[model samples]
Structure formats: structure tokens, C-alpha cells
Target: MLARDESDLKRTPLHALHLARGGKMVPFAGYEMPVQYPAGVLKEHLHTRSHAGLFDVSHMGQIALRPKSGKVSDAALALERLVPQDILGVAPGRQRYAQFTNADGGILDDLMVANFGDHLFLVVNAACKAEDEAHLRKHLSDACDIDSLADRALIALQGPKAESALAKICADAPSMKFMDAGPRRVAGFDCFVSRSGYTGEDGFEISVPAEHAEALVTQLLDNPDVLPIGLGARDSLRLEAGLCLYGHDIDTTTTPVEAALEWSVQKSRRKGGARTGGFPGAEKILDQFERGAPRRRVGLKAQGRAPVREGAALFADADTGEAIGKVTSGGFGPSLNAPVAMGYLPTALSGIGTTVFAEVRGQRLPLAVAATPFVPNTYKR
Candidate 1:
């Protein structure tokens, strides 16, 4: 999500609740969102890692695509034209991570696609929603019914205890596993609950009606294990999980391969697979798959306590070093109690344990290319 002017910012259905909880509101994705609550970012980050954290992600965009032929596979096939994922293979009540790529092989936006038997549901970034909707309509309208779910609000219940907390209010929560998604009555409200989240933990992302968003969130928070988390903690959590933030770690400038997201592009979409080279930039992406991208995204661990922030230039040496790349996302990993970051580095220098330099505050600080999930992922399979 992109930041906007405060005066022009919008509010989510739970805006009043945020303010009531002493949230520190800031402009984000054209919305006045809470960056941190009274408990603060550090506590929120650690709280989420240990227990459950509820996030008000209502600013995101929810869209539905129903096939004109009344077959879900038809819609999936249509969607494959826009992304390089094997959407047709996604089973009912299952979800997959995908990206909308431009004609030049750059990532336009990363999104979640859930198969709902009859229709497909999509959750896209708030800042790119309008353009994403337009892109979908322009390409798939002839084969599917494109509907923007403007009345829905999104919330993510993530962490180690998320399932237990949610199961109390939604009995079906226990039956769902990772990547399982479908319509479920949550907190007695009709909603779509996906057993998936950005945080690398057992969690759920629920899509509730705008009118009942506050009630649902309030009910979840009533559980002592669940705390309200803001954007600050959310970023730190995803960063530690080795996940990408749309505009920061990925954007129109980076392809899935360059971003180290090649795992998301299934073999079915690659060369010699059942469906090969139909999506945009297939030539470039597939070629990268066959060979490799020049530069690759890698995890960076700072040698000291100071956090390395985004946009910090990377150097090949500590002194008189040539600029090799730049840090895309960097921050302190509360779980690891150390600074962690991610950036692009030439493939030759992207190996784990490779030492690099990050120019920060007129100093070239040494950083090691470490294995990701700066902390181990607790995702329940």
C-alpha cells in the first residue's frame, strides 16, 4: 500500500475502534490507518510472535470472478492469462499466491486467489486495487463476471495461537489447514475465511461485511490471546517471515524470478509444462526459470544492533566498495533480537554466509547474506 496526503485519506469501517484503542493513525494507501497502538510496535511485534494478533486490513481490495461458462476451471484458465500460476489446478476451498505481471515481466501486484467452487475470490493490495480491477476487467471480462466486493472488509488473525482463538467463535476454523479457504460463518457472520496470512504462522484472513467488521474484530479481541496489531508490527512480522511487501520488496521493476519468488510460479506454467508461455512476459519469466536472473533477492543480517533500513545502498567492500545493490526491506527482527534485511545481489554474491556491506550514515556496515525466515516459520501445514 502507498501513503497519501492526510487530508485526502479515507477511513475503514473500524476506524473509530482504532482511535478508541489509542491507535497512532497515519496516512497509508490513501487511508488513515493505525501504525501502532498504545502498546507500541515492539510489544505488538513480539506479542504476535508468541500469541495471536488481529490486523485491520480492510483497506485491501476484494474481488470476485465468476466464470461465464459456469465452470470454475474456465475462470481459472482465464486468470492464468494474466498470471503465471497454475490456477486451474487450485482445488475448491484452496488458495494460492499469485502475482499480476506486466507485459515486460515485472510484477504489477502480488495477490491471493482462492477457489470457491463456483467463483474465484481475490485479495489485492489497497494502493493497486483500482488498477488491478481494471486490468482484470479488461482481460477476463469476456470469460468471467468481474465483481468488486466493495462492501467487504478484510482482517487477518495471525500467530501461533490464532487457530485456537478463532475456533472459539468459528467452529470450522479447526478443520481448515494452511492454504484452505472458503466461505465460513465467523463470529456468527457470513464471511470468507482463508487459513492463510502474510505472517509465517498458523493464521486466518477473514473477509467480513463492512457493517459487522467492528463487531467481529471486537469479538476476536475479547480473547485474551488476541491483541490488536498495526502496520508497524505487520511489516516486521512479514519481513522476518521472508515475505515481500508489494511496493517495497517487489514492484513494477522486479520480476518474480528476480524477487526470489520462483517457487510461486508452478512448473505447470514453466517450459514444457501442461500450460506454458500463455501469460504476460512468459518469454522473459520462463527464460529466467530455465537459466536464472542476473540479480537475486537475498536475506541480510547486520553485524551489530543498528537496524539497516530500506534504500540503503549495498557495497561489495567495506571501503572503496562498488555499489552492487540496495536494501529493499530492512528492520530489527524482534524475534531474533537483531537487525535483519533483504536486498538484491548478484547471483555470485547471493550465497548464504556471503558478507556484504550496506552504506548507512556515511559508514559501510558489514552484513551477511543469511538464510531467510530470519526466524524459523511456524506455519502449520
Candidate 2:
């Protein structure tokens, strides 16, 4: 692990605790997050799949967006106007994944929005928090309050054993369904717990007060089944699960439909027609929906042991050398034990089993458009 000066990188609330546990900190999203522990990224990736792995994701922005007029429905409608998800139908204690879109229907960022009784809670990417918060405040009416919860720390306990591990600390842990959230008392501290994660595993993301983060994390890690994980493994895990990283797979230039995330657009939006199509790039998105995007995101598999990284140019024909697309996210999938990648190619060449070529260091490598989730996702529902 490469160790840089702790002063240069921002630290989460549990930064000291991570160092104490032999965590190797690295710069990620401007924070000194652990990319791996003493066990290494490979082991951490495997541990999170087979057992429970605790991850400190405190850098992620947590914000509360209360309706301007103190009316929850108004806030939901306002948010639904911007995102593709059905936020208006979100029942109390339930959360929905949504995308922040630009005028062109390109994704600005992906976030989780939860309806917490009277208020709405949002979990946004750490890297895009500033832009996201500013956008939310500027667009929302004064009746709504957009407040950041910087005093809180976020932690994810991911894997099939997440419930058992968390149950050791909180009694009602097992009853929570996927995407369900609630406030709970753990070790005499009030914390908000959600049954959700990014690794495509059954898990929970716990939001604890910064002052209490250390003790709460300690209690969870004390369980024999729980190990500490880091960002490197988190990337590999999401890759195997076919989930997109904000700046990688999905970006400002990639529309949700082109990225094959049309499911994120709720049925109401599709049915409302012109009335609901008031969001940024709505015309283009609706047109794409009516017609179709010229290019589509697809998964790729290298035909050799060498792992392909992002920026590899994709070719239209193996022998023609015609450039068609480029690799977005690529890595050695720990779960699949092979090299897997994702990229966007011309619609005609995006079919499954289509042979493609990738230019790696001037060497033409054979590739193929394969079905994603290279490894079957084990998400709990």
C-alpha cells in the first residue's frame, strides 16, 4: 500500500480508527480512504462476498431535503421532476435509486433518496456533492430546506452475512427489507440504518453520528464474521455486479436509456407524456425512448488473461480497424476470476456475442460483447 501524507488527504471521522486497524489509506474522492486493509483488496473482495465486510463510506454526502411548504408531496413532486425514479410513490421508510440528470438527459450523478417519515433523505456521491447540493438548493423552492449532515458518518456492512453481523448489535436488524430504512438505537446511540449497499450483496449502510462512529464500528467489527473492506474491492465488487460507477460507466455524456437504465424511469413519467417531460434534456430522452439511442452500453470480456483497463479503444471489426467505442470501466473481477469490462458501442455492434477488438498499447486484442453481471448478483431481492 502507498502511504501519502495524511495532511494532504482529507480524513473521515474514523480515519484514526482505520490506521489503528492496519488500514492502508489512499486518496479517493479527495479523502484518505482505505483502498485495502492488511488483508489486501483481493481478500477484502472475497470476504465481502462470503462474509460481512465493513466499509467506511463517510465521505458520501448525506443531506435532508424537506419540502418548502413543509408538505412532503411537494418535495416528492419536485424531485420526481428532476429524476427518473418514482419518488412520489416512495412509502415511508423506503428508498429509491435515482439519477441526477442534465438537460441532455445525461446522468450527472446517481443517488439514493429515502422518505423518512416527514422528510426526504439523500445519499449522493462524494465527488459530486458540491454540484448536487447547489443544484438542489437552486432549483428547490424556499419552502424546502436542503441541509447537509456533515456530522454523520456512513458505514456499509455488505455480504450475505450482513444481517447476522448487524443483528449482534441491533435487535431489529433482520426485519428490515431491501431498500428499507429506519432509525435504531445501537449501543445506546441513536443511528439510522438502511438495508442497502453497492456490492450487489445483502447489506446495510449505517449512518452514525461522527462522535459515536468509532464505538459503533468497533462493535460491528468485533463479530467474527465481519472484516474491514476498502475502495479497491468495492470497485471490483460493483464491476462483477454490473453496477456503474458515477464518472466511469455513466457520465454527463451518457443518457440513462443509452446506458440501459431505462428501468430507473418510472411508469408515471412514461405515461404522463408532455406534462412530465419537463426535466433537463427531456425532449432528447423522450425522443430516444420513442425512437432509440444510436449507441448502447454493453459488457465486454477479453479473450486472454491480461486485464484491460479503461481508455482502451474498441474497434468495429477485428480486421477493419475501424474505431467504434471505448472501454469505460474494466478490471479483473474477483468473483468471476476473469477480466471483465463495460463500454458503449454502436447499436449495430452492441449485441451479445458480437466479436470486437480492443487496442491495448498498440496491440489489437480480441474481445466480445458479453452479457453483464459477469458473476450472478446475490442482491437480497
Candidate 3:
């Protein structure tokens, strides 16, 4: 693939801050983003595991769904038409993870939906934001007001000490629990704060106005415990946390069940539930929930010191014969001090501790089917 021109890439609200802090900018999701800072990926990854790490995720898409009927339930029900998740069950001040599945049960995109009383807030992947917005407008424009938040900037403060660092500026930060979300004055900026993050850690995702985003992030970074983190650390953190990266661990070709994301689908959307089988690909997805997907996503732990990377073919035996599966995401888990990978495997061979061989370089490396969140999550539930 040809590299995107840096001049043509979009810049986040904190682009200047990243440059000032010696961040190595790279093209990602049509945006000029910082992949790492002067601290380096390893240190950044470890720091986030131990202390608080601030991330500028402004390139992500923020959207609002306001019900024309003035009832949030109406908007939720409208959204349920697109996602298989029980959006109506997400109470006000709370959020839930969901996916936009296609007619063939493939995931269009995975997103976060938060109920904020009168309206619903959505955060979609940066790369798929345009398509996601178009989808919402095509299907839900009649029931709700689809507004794309183009002037907002999103940032994440994540880790064990994230709450303490955020609490210094936003007093209500300490009161919020996991998945709790609402509007708050964060460092004198009118921002939306959610106690949820991609990293399996206790953290907050804050959305502020574009103009004030830099100032707010600067304030948060001023805290002694908070450090500016980049995409390199963010990827490792989420991978170790067993969280899926939209285009990598999952994509339009992968379904929720096949990706090991059945938990995100509430019972209300399943067969025999109150409201069932109305979303796209309901038949195929629901069927998978009842029976099982042909293949399942599982954690892979490399037996040797060398790291197993993505696109590596997996085989049942050491001698590569027919490739049964492929690694979707893989790399060194700095927190684990070892190599961790995730991939798909046939249902019969996806059991925990089942051995599989990943073809890396010219040699086949032995890998074990391991339970995920290789590192335990620290969400303050």
C-alpha cells in the first residue's frame, strides 16, 4: 500500500502538543497521529500499566442521536435496528459496547454507545466513522436527529491512577463507576466524560470542544502521575487487555460471535427475549449464538522468547500442512514481558491449552491456546 501524503492527512486538536513533546507522527486512519513519544513504546506501555497515561484520540468520530419524540428509548430502539445489542437496556448515564453487523453477520464496525438522558452518544472508529455516520443517517434519520460531532476532541486518561489524576480537575471523577458516562466540567471545559476505555484499566474518555481540547489535555498532563501516551503503547495495552482493535482483531469479514464478543449482545436481542432478531444479520448472528461459529477467536501464547506477529498462518501440527487459521493481531506484551497473540481457530481446536503452531519466518513456532486479558483488567466496577 502506498503511504498517504502527510499534508493530506487530518491533524487532531493536539497535533501541536504531540510535535512539541517529540512525538513521532505517523499516518493512521487518514490522520496524522503520534505513534510514540520520546519516552518510547516500552516505557510508555509500562508507565500506563503502573501510572496514568493521557492519550489524544481526537481523530475518532463522535456522534449524537437525539430522539425526535424526546424520549431516549425511542432513539435507543432506532439504534437497535442497526446493532444487535439491546440499546434500550443501556440506562441513562451508562454506556455499552456494540457492533454494526452486516447482512452476512460480518461486523461493519465496533462502537461504544452511551445513553445521556435525552440523547445517545456514539464513538465510532476513526477509519469507519464516515461509513458509520452514513449508515445512521440512512436508517435512523426519520426517528432521530443524527448529528456528527466534528468540532469535538476526544482524549483518554487511563491506568490505575487515572481516577486520582482526573479527580484533581473534575471533582465528580471519583464518583463515576465503570461504564458510567455523562457531561461534566473537566478543568473548566464543558466536556463529556466516560469511565470507560479501550485499555482494560480504570480510566476515563473525555470529549471536549476542539478549541479547549489542547488546554484541557495540557492541564491533565501537568499532573505528576500522568504522562502523554501514543498509539504504540495504546495498541499493546489494549492487546494485553484482550480488547479488539477494530480493523485488526475485527473487521467487516468477522462477526461478533466469531470474534468472541457474544457478551456484548444482550439477552434482550437474543431469541426468546423481549425484542429479538430485528437488527441486520440477525438470523445468522442469532444462529451462531445458539449453535456456534465455525471458528472462534482465542488468545495465543508463544512458547519461545521470539514474538509471533500478525498474518502468520497457524497449523495444528509442527510441520506446516494445511493452514487452519491465521493470526489477526500479535506482538510483544510489555506488561507480560512475553509475546501474546490473538487469532481464529476451528471450534474443536480452540479449547484452552490446546497447542497450535504459528508459521513465523521459515520455522513453525508452537503456541498455546490461552485465556485472554493475559494481564488482569483493573476496571473499577
lDDT of 2 at 165: 84
Error of 3 at 54 (Å): 0.4
Q: Which ten residues in a row have the lowest lDDT in candidate 3?
A: 1-10
Q: List model 1 lDDT by residue over 245-345, tens digit each.
A: 99999999899999999989998899999999799988999999989999999999999988999999999988985899999999998888999999999
Candidate 3 TM-score to native: 0.99
lDDT for 86 in candidate 1 is: 97
Q: Which of candidates 2 and 3 reaches a greater lDDT?
A: 3
Q: Can you list the residue pairs that collide in candidate 1?
A: none
What's the true lDDT of residue 54 in model 1? 95
- Candidate 2 lDDT tens digits, 1-381: 222665667789999989998988778877998888899989999999999899999999999989867778778888876787778888989888889889988999999999887889999999899889999988875557899999999999999899998888898888888999868876678888889998988999999999999999999888989999989999999888888999989999999989988877877676464345767777788788879899999999999977888999899766675789999999898878889999999988899999888888888788889987787766555
TM-score of each predicted structure versus truth: 0.98, 0.95, 0.99
- The C-alpha lDDT values of all candidates are 0.94, 0.87, 0.94
Clash pairs for candidate 3: none
| Candidate 2 structure lDDT | 0.87
Worst 10 residues of 2 by lDDT: 1-10
